[model samples]
Target: MGSAVLVLAIGVWLVQDGVRTELPPRPSSAQSFPAAAAPADDGRQRATKPSIPGMGASPPIRIRIRAILVDAPVIPLTLDAEGHLEPPPPDDNNLVGWYEGGVAPGQNGTAVMAGHVDNKRGLSVFYGLGSLRPGAEVEIERKDRTTAVFSIDAVEEYPKDRYPSDKVYGETSRPELRLITCGGRFSKETGYQSNVVAYAHLTRAKSA
Candidate 1:
């Protein structure tokens, strides 16, 4: 197989949250959001405002995991024609993308975040994702400046052919997060053979 086929296969392998499909074209400029603005002095930024999932749904702006020393911005991603959730732009190795159609990080369902393990150059945003263990904390900063704290439940890997999509993207009683990246042996013909998933649930929410 050619390099393009390898890259595309790896991209699809990294995303198992939505309907399986091929990768989409590069997102248009309109898909990108502006830089988050600083909070005003009046303390308005301290408020936790809810959006779509009603009570506590705010779009995540950044993600932090102190144990792994990961501090990365979050981008919203949409599915392509075949319903596959797009990965973060390959050129920006430090960013992660959240599946916009799914439950937000602070809402009452699983919120999926996917990132590349590495590109042709080197390590990517989620290169350390699988190293995270149970009890470690994953903090997601929302546009409202409130941080939704999640406690890692487990780190699991599954073969690409047997991906547990229903469990990974299934409904939950409380807010939860799933961090996904490529793992296992890599082959020029088939890409990574497994996916590394980090499972966590909300433990607390506070003003940033």
Candidate 2:
């Protein structure tokens, strides 16, 4: 998808459909990159073990993040007729949307996943995404009966208009993951003012 289309789709689909009385936790400044600094590549080389090889294409079936107690099924997300990527069904708070058009979770490229921060009933799947810290593990179970393990590198919140599409969706020589959700200020008119994105890189993979 075009970067412009992705920006619009994420801004629109990630927001809560109805007013939520309580907002999800926002990523603190300590978790974000310094204003003048760009996202670093050091994390990918920080692994102590020998680098693990990326796997072939295999759709993700589930995602588990022990740090925040996230254990949700992942559904393939496709673009609508209007060419906007679709979000997961609003009624299913535990479901996550995996951009099927992008690289799979275990593949040697950036894989994008998004979840709702909140819904009308209450906090949803990614409500605590901003709380994740470096070194936390995110495990994605794939259709091939393998689990791809990723380590958190950073969590940052950006205004919708200023989101760095290139950093989040850019290609990578190694497997990487991005978990996103609506965050920052909210309004009945605009939904949300910003988005919380968690950056991670694959560390290991194992058979399920």
Candidate 3:
């Protein structure tokens, strides 16, 4: 097995509370955020604010991935053992294998959602994630009924240990999204050896 994770130091958000995380080192420095600027001489320190991801002046409502619309649910976020994130389950796959965070979809940064490719059975949600083409679209629906659409810009796979940390999870200058699922082979000795990452970028967003 490759001891090298692409950039794993990986951080994934779980809730509005911003479930804290440590992401792997990034493959690209362009995605890296600078450390908080030094505080001024005043007693007050510099308040480093994280930019809202995906929900800026213009928010996305629908995304298209693998030619499917990720329609927004009346309530996109859910919790019950499975974790929370932007794109929740597809109303199937009965298992503790989902994201539990709020789902307005953070802006500017990468609003992430995750699922399991398989449990003990075999072939679960996101099992086809590797099949997503670069141009596939992912749609996210909103409260107003409008849809925000994005296109798959790239897809990269990484070994568990070598997953790039900074690039995948770091803050971005542009709004982006990440869909994650387990990939590669598993080992009784270890675990899943790789992670499948689908990278998508906004193309069209509407506020129906």
Clashes (N, CA, C under 3 Å) per candidate: 0, 0, 55
lDDT of 3 by residue, 1-208 (tens): 0111212212222111211122222223222223332111111211332222255433333333435223322223343243323333333432222122322343454555565454444444455666666567676665456665666655666776667655566555545667766555555444456777777655666665
Judged by TM-score relative to the true structure, which candidate is superior, 1 or 2? Answer: 2
What does candidate 2's lDDT look like per residue over 97-131, in tens digits? 99998889989878889999887667789989989
TM-score of each: 0.75, 0.91, 0.56
lDDT (tens digit, per residue) of candidate 1 on 1-208: 1223223443575533322122212222222222341111112311331112323778999999998778999999876675555667777768888877777888887788888777655667777777776678898999988888887766776677777666566555567778878776566666667777777767788895
* lDDT of prediction 2: 0.84
Return whichever of 1 and 3 wins on lDDT: 1
Residue 186 shift from truth in candidate 1, angstroms: 1.0
Residue 32, model 2, lDDT: 72
What is the model-wide C-alpha lDDT for candidate 3? Answer: 0.45
The candidate scoring highest on TM-score is: 2
The candidate scoring highest on lDDT is 2
Ten residues in sequence with the least summed lDDT for candidate 2: 42-51
Candidate number with the higher lDDT (2 or 3): 2
* Ten-residue stretch with the least lDDT total in model 1: 37-46
